[model samples]
Target: MHKTNFAALALLSAACLTGMSSAATPAQKGFITGTVVNEQGKPLPGVEIDVDNTLSYDSSLITYTDAKGQYRVDVRKLPFTFQVYAKMKLKYGDSTVNVELVPNNPDAVAGLAGGVRDFVFKPKPVTAEDPYGNLGRVFVERGIGEYDVDTAQVQVTLTPVGTLADGSAGKARTFKLLPSGGGPVIPNVMWGKYQVTATLNGKALQIRQRTDGRTPATWGAAYTGGFTRDYNALTPSMFLEVRVPRAGD
Candidate 1:
């Protein structure tokens, strides 16, 4: 018994000295595939997708969408953490997407090597209504990204998801913001959900938002435009911080 214990300790010590991590191996490892589209149901071709995970792997998976806005990446971990970042150059400007994925258990997952998850990238425009009710507030803490301190004001536009997507717009509002993060903008509309868009110099500005996830819900997000598709919603009676990527980021 004494000899066995000593040998086990020696092995552990050697592993530590070798800088070996006992990162838990997921029950499975495979590739993941999915599609990206605009709110109008149009595929966002050429969109770059970046997936970050930690499973003793080298780094994140950097991939891009095909002509049909589809992408597939070969990975080595299942039920692993997925922090996704997507960006596509559009006529208006560059559209960025961020997503937090909580995939189903690999032990029970079916179809395809990595499963499928589709996304619709659309920023909501603020609608107009009587000033009253359970109205929530959204705050833009500060502009981070690559913007200079002199960034006078970012163009803030709020529109309903589909209303503006189909070129049919009667409910759209725009606001001007400072690089130092300006907001507390109260909508004249009733308490409800609103989409957020922050742009610097007519170009899409990647901002950060807090989401209910494990991937740096706060800290995990550094400079990489904290803007995820679903994370940028403004809820009634809530004040959300619209942050650009970290300055140095």
Candidate 2:
């Protein structure tokens, strides 16, 4: 029994010295670090970052920005080189969207070589090529059991309540809803609070934000999934529900 144990130990030592064992060398490692900042060049803290290592078994790691808007991720360096990329989760009002972050240091996209890779939230103009525009989607709905009218003629207005995310004074907008029943989505609008109002054929309609899952009264109306469903930032982005209110309230 003693001889057998000694022989096995000797064999393991020989294997390691000959580089024939997995434990012969430790896995190499490198790190990636960066800071997140807003478009105005102010540091943005508490931002979640995803560091993806493409073409490697060790695929990804997650990190968040500190109070100083800085983050770091340790990555294992494999013999075969692979590209590394970073992504970020950004908040627009009550909604959140994932953006593929472009690093200021372009070389960071290549194999890991410890360096600074900063990110800035500089939104570009919405174009056909970029469907994920900087705008937010607001779902508009006419309350059930409400008076019927032509949606095309309904004039909807959105008045900004305060300064926009970029600290610019927001402008009021008015638009007509889609007539084909395809979309209640308000077009070309930024994500923020808005005082919504609507007029149908010169008659005012009662408006409320159903973002809290509160539904207007539907006399004897039945829904498949019931009338209430909780949503983050209403549904997807925000919801503006309008209905003709009965008199004497």
Candidate 3:
């Protein structure tokens, strides 16, 4: 396990074993409320929202949306410097969307007072078909298996076509390279054309393309310009491997 990972885990464990109760008493009352919906702007019920007050040592809260897609969690100990964020494995219909929201965004979290603050989310939906257009897939492989994933910081950008009715563009996500650098999976991309670009801290990135899951791999598409899916044909999957000129071979 990475040292950074261990530190965070220790913090959570300590807090859980000896922190304030799940909810703060009335005296230190701070609350956050919010609604969740799908791309079509419809209420999404039963979605689980996980809240974390990272700034606070005693932080860990969980809540789910009700029938009306509404949720309220007591962010009680709103220290003058308290920062609270809410996240959920967003789902619509029966599919889980892949939009992993980065909390702490000034606008993503409502800066609540001694009262409740409301927020809204429009989770992208995953396609229900093969070569699923609804979801975008990513596989991150390292330049060499020995390279430490913990040391790699990767940011992937996916820009959708401007006039897309399903959704708009400027959707990006970041990941601390997975075990061998292949763990973070980007999902629930509103079916549309995209311009994909990626970069690494100490190396360059090259993305190989494979149609759906059946065809052979091709040597193209570092920036998949307006990638489209054909359900009847094959699906498009990205094979992102790091370019590190190793010493051994």
Task: For candidate 1, write residues 1-249 as lDDT tens digits.
Answer: 011122343355344424412212222236666677764657777777766664436576788888987877765445565655565432211332132211112122232245444544543222223221122234454433433623335555554444221234435566553222223343322222346566656666554454444634443232222122244553323233444455575
Order of the predicted models by TM-score, top scorer first:
2, 3, 1
Q: For residues 91-167, write the lDDT of model 2, one tens digit per residue.
A: 55554555544345444333444445666555323322332324455556776556584555567767677765445
Candidate 1: residue 177 lDDT (0-100): 32
**Candidate 2 TM-score versus the reference:** 0.47
TM, every model: 0.34, 0.47, 0.36
Error of 1 at 91 (Å): 6.4
Model 3: lDDT of residue 67: 92
Candidate of highest lDDT: 2
Better of 2 and 3 by lDDT: 2
Best by TM-score: 2
lDDT of 2 at 100: 49
lDDT of each structure? Answer: 0.43, 0.52, 0.44
Candidates' RMSD to native:
20.8, 20.4, 13.1
